[model samples]
Target: MDWTALWLSMRLAAWTVAILLPISVLMGRFLAYRQFRAKGMVEALVMLPLVLPPTVFGFYLLVAFGRNSPVGDLWQGLFGHQLVFSFEGLVVASVIFNLPFAVQPAQRGFEAIPVEVREAASCCGMSPLASLWKVELPLAWPGLMTAMVLTFAHTLGEFGIVLMVGGSIPGETKTIAISIYDKVQGFDDRSAGIMSAVLVAISLFTIALTYWLSARMGRRLS
Candidate 1:
């Protein structure tokens, strides 16, 4: 097995989760508690990555963040390197692509919190932030855990966007999925098989955890 690629994939997943967690919490809470116009449209935009073809999404990301693009130029000016084919680029792409996975469950978690509970927190002189940290989060942890687990596992197995945007730079952008593909292309079946099995195991665990969390959340809400 290409341990380096595995490590790189893990690192990328971690970064993606770290960057998305707070954003997920905020966005999820907003979507859960608020009734606003065009909410469905907002949700559709978030879910777009899940449905969109990875190759098409990656092409858009490449064009939007390429050296000639404004965002790319700005990043290059500050970072002294191009965003495309870099680890940072992969992190950014992963975060965007995994938005629905992270946000949707968090929304469900936050939605599980009863309005009366939030009102009671406020009546007890709790600030919005305090209510969120002390009252809301505890009640919604299972859903949030499901979100993070899904995001982490999905990030590990994601191949198209990473390949398109970051390429196969060893120890940099060559994630486990890409490594498996490379091994297969090189006719290294043993290595590919090992990595594939590892990913399959991770995916199974993720799904199991998600189901358990969903059940717990349902019971809590019920």
Candidate 2:
């Protein structure tokens, strides 16, 4: 098994989850509270990753971040490099690809907060941010944990989008999922199986840990 690929995948998943968590909390809160025209359309757009093919999403990202495109040009001019075929590129792809897993769970968790409680907090003059930090967030811990676990798991298994944007550059853009694909293509079944088993074990352990921690915390809160 390629230990480098294994390490890269773990790194990517960790970073993706870390980045997604705060954004997910914000987006989730917005979706749960904000009301405006075209809100449904906006939600659909955010969820496009789930419905659209990963390749299609990856293609769009490639175009948007590739050299000669406006954002890409700006990025290159400022940073002195292109986003394509790099670790940053893979991270960008994974974030877009696994966003819904984080957002949806967070939204649901926030929604589970009773409306009257927010109203009561407002009656006491607590600002929206204060209420969110002191009241809403504490009640939504379980859902947030679910979001973190799901997002991490989803990112760990990401393939099509990462492959398209990252192009399998070893120790740079090659994640374990892509590495497993390379092993199969090379007829290295033993290595692929080893990596696959490792991924499966990690996923299972993460999910189990999330559940256990959440339950234990809930009991303590009770």
Candidate 3:
């Protein structure tokens, strides 16, 4: 097992979760509370990654972030390196690829908050943000927790997108999933099995913990 790849995968997942949590909260709240034009289209766009093939999505990302593209050129000029095949690039890809896993649950959570509670918060002169922070979030803790767990876990198992965007660069962009693929291709079945088992164990533990916490939060809310 490549410890560096394991560490990189953890780092990528952590960064993806950290960046998306607040963004998911905001997007989820908006979709839950707002009734705007093109809402369905926006929601569909947000969910596109969930349904789209990961490699296809990563191909677009590669183009968008490649040195030939405008964004890539600008990024390169400013940062002195292309975004493609970098750790930062991996984070960006992970965030996009796992966005729906984070956003959908959070949106559902926000929607579950009773209108009366929000009205009460309003009556008490709390701002919208304050109401969300104090009332809706407390009531919808389960959904938020689910989003975080799903996002982290989804990122851990990512393969096609990470491979397309970052390739397999040990300690730089090679994640555990990529490492596992490499091990298997190299005929290192023992290492591949060990890494695969570790991922399965981690994923199972995360899912179980999420469910347990969600159930507890539901009881508390009730």
User: Which candidate wins on lDDT?
Assistant: 1
lDDT of 3 by residue, 1-222 (tens): 788999999999999999999999999989998999999999999999989999899999999999899988988999999799999989998998888999999999989888888999999999988987888889877888999999999999999999999988899999999999999999999999999999999999999998888788778867
TM-score of each: 0.93, 0.95, 0.97
Worst 10 residues of 3 by lDDT: 213-222
Candidate 2: misplaced stretches above 4 Å? none
> Model 1, 1-222: lDDT tens per residue?
999999999999999999999989999999999998999999999999999999999999999999899999999999999999999999999999999999999999999888999999999999999998989998888878888998999999999999999999999999999999999999999999999999898789878977887787779757
**Candidate 3: lDDT of 199?**
94
Instruction: State, as a TM-score between 0 and 1, how close model 3 is to the true structure.
Output: 0.97
Look at candidate 1 and give me any clashing residue pairs.
none
lDDT of each: 0.94, 0.89, 0.92
Give the local distance difference test score of model 1: 0.94
Off by over 4 Å in 3: none
What is the alpha-carbon lDDT of model 2 when measured against the actual structure? 0.89
- Candidate 1 regions off by >4 Å? 205-222
Q: Which pairs of residues clash in candidate 2, taking residues 3 or more apart in a chain or in different chains?
A: none
